[model samples]
Target: MTVASPLRFPDTASAPTMTKRGWWLVVMNILLPGSAQVLAGNRKLGRVGIVATLVLWLLAILTLLTYLIWPSTVYTLFTQTFSLLVVQILLVAYAALWVVLTLDTLRLVRLVKAAPNARAWIAAFSVVVLIGLTCTAGYASVVAGSARGALGDIFSSGPSQPPVDGHYNIMLLGGDAGPDREGLRPDSMSVVSIDAETGQAVTIGLPRDLNPVPFPTDSPLHSLYPDGYGYEDRCDVDVCQLNSIYTEVSLYKPELYPQAEKQHSDPGIESMRDALEGATGLKIQYYVLIDMQGFADLIDSLGGVDVTVSEKLPIGGDENLNGVIDWIEPGKQHLNGYYAQWYARSRHGTSDYDRMARQRQLQDAILKQVNPVNVVSKFQGIADAGTQVVKTDIPQSMLGYFVDLGMKTRKLPVKQLELVPPTIDPANPDYSQIHQLVQEALAPATPTPTSSK
Candidate 1:
């Protein structure tokens, strides 16, 4: 019998086989974490990874379904503090697990045993995948944490408020607290009345100079200014305007809004809310105060805005103290933060009504430009700027509802009624007539009856 050659099996795979194995291991790890270990390396570790991956898949499917069925609930999860914290923790944990599995898969690849030409390729591919996976998960984790911080810093932890008269009326106040100003004064005031069911909205703009603003019968300030806000015989225009309510009440009549502090609000805001409610005949549920000083930062973070400049507007320099430093010329122009701010605020040669129209136009431009892609791309900058720019009494609990309402409002045409000029004299507004106009603007269009054939 021929001397039986001592049967020998190859201890390491052949070059081509090793190359294919290396590629397959990396691919398997990506498609199904821990699968590489089960195929050749550590079975126990691979089983755990497989289980985790399965759980992850199930969770992903469940989350998608929830978002599709009840988007508000999903929004609530992302907005609430406790839920956001939980999400951040889970994201971090998932990121760590992914990193571990990717490393293990690389170890199992045994790149040294691969073909010399294929070794570099396999190693490079694995590294790129590792860095890509690690960075994506890591970035997502950071984003979740940032959102949690922003929500906690920006939104109040107050109780949810109900809509009044089938409408959720929110007061948007643009406060102009310049370096030369004495105190914070709301330069722009608008009540956004949104239909609770349809999300149809009507913006009722109140000029800052509107005098003798009325207060609701239930408001404590009503007793003090029964005739209306700044109704005294020799009332000063600067002190008696609608925007002055905030500073006036906060400084001299804090006692009028005793419950403001408890409700996460200041006396000034409550006073303004009360005055606007009385003026517009709409129950204001929430107030968002935008500091005009920080408005430029917000616009910049959104990559600037496109606005139509009807005439040349001054950028800087006081009209009395010094002439305009620069001018924003007419026609459709893309303006950065500084110019956009001036576009909405320049009052050197323009009337308050002109400024109001520009403000409204700027607002519409922002609404039109703020798509999901822009928001996601510049999320970090926007979040940072938002915290410094906005102050609101809208509670975190109700954010989900508002977000849903906002989405609906975006799809519909926004109706506006500025309390100025021929429509309603801002200098001496007729309270009853203002109420009637508001009703007409908010009323759903009645379908014309079809004529019978």
Candidate 2:
């Protein structure tokens, strides 16, 4: 009876045949990231993909807004909780997601022999997308790896140092360790104090000859010396010197700073930090030790800094030897690496105080020159140069925080103080006066109220 009813069945021959290649599906996936799934019987996944893509775009927009409108909030988050491991994991997950989406799209893209040209175009598009995705992933991985290596090489992992009075103090040391020198001797010493909230910064430059340096009460140096670093024993033959802290600890008194190995990874710098902290009356969280020899290369990588040469600064010279080969003419000059290093370190015809001021000016000029565009353009070269140029105890986990703080600080004018001559006697520095100066330097600037018309 059913056969007698004319065998009514769906017209299978009238239906359009789906070929192996669906070029349009691949194109759809490329455009919308989920449309291929929608057409290939994965509506739920397609919706998820769409939602995820939208969320990602929304997050990007929000991040940009945060950077522009609420930089403080962004800085806080970065300093408090940002981690490189988390960033790397997220990057890997994103790359994996892209790979999955590409594979799924390819699967949906069934080939049609009749539309060979269309298939070829789709294949080409897929190839291009794949290459782009792969290159992007590779680049991200390289950057992450470079950062990880740099951090590991430069910083030590230890308990996070708390800020003092809502300010994080970092001791920057420009070490001049030549072949004849006994050990690393920091010629230039400065304490960089950064306000935790506002990112306002102040640089307190301490002369190299600063003597009778006090030690923190908690430091073993305080216990051993009791009075000062070189009160009982001198560093340079018969005189106590501040620059001697690095060489003395690293070469002469390693046993005294055993904790430095575990905490800071550089006992010399760590000892210097402890002494500087006590002298400055600021809790130094970290130390950035720059090799003076490599300073030129670092500046060169930044395309040379444009500094206003106030006087005829000697170039290519050391403290003891008259290596003055040239003089940077008094004017606004674009100084390359060699000249910039000399500008920062040369004391040929200038006093230590003048050199210090020039060093600070050079620092400011370099900061102005090292903009984001220049940095991005020379990222690889800079990273390579940085490896040899500087060392620090700033942990990788806190790198992002500092980077954000630095960005915030770049907008603010850098305040400077030199502990030289009439300001404060280096040999007999008044501790009370030094502390007061630090307090005043860190004091918040009074806001000028708007004049009501």
Best by lDDT: 1
Tell me the tens digit of each residue's lDDT in model 2 across 1-453: 353121122122321232222555566666776656755646777777666667667867987899888665654443332344555566676666666676777665554432545556667777798679767766666665665566566665665677788999989898887897776788889999999878899999998888788999988678766788777564543457888777767776788777666775567887888889888988888888889988888888888889888888666657654666888899889989988887887677778889889888988777666777887566666777788988877865576577778887889999998888899998788989999998999999999999999
User: Candidate 1, after superposition: displacement of residue 426 in Å?
Assistant: 2.0
lDDT of 1 by residue, 1-453 (tens): 221111111125577766777788888888998787777667888898888889889988988999899988887777788887777787777768778887887777777877899988887887888788778767766767777888888888888888888889999989899888778888888999999988898888888888878999999888878898777632333566888778777777789878888887789899899999999999898999888899999999999999878887777887663766888999989999988888888888888988887887888788778887887678788889999999898999998888888878888888999989888887788999999999999898799999999
lDDT of 1: 0.83
Q: How many backbone clashes does candidate 2 have?
A: 5
Each model's backbone clash number: 1, 5
Spell out the clash pairs found in candidate 2. Answer: 20-110, 20-111, 21-110, 21-111, 22-110
- Runs in model 2 deviating more than 4 A are 1-27, 34-130, 223-239, 300-303, 317-327, 369-377, 448-453
At residue 421, give the lDDT of candidate 2: 87
Q: How close is candidate 1 to the true structure, as a TM-score?
A: 0.94
Error of 2 at 120 (Å): 8.5
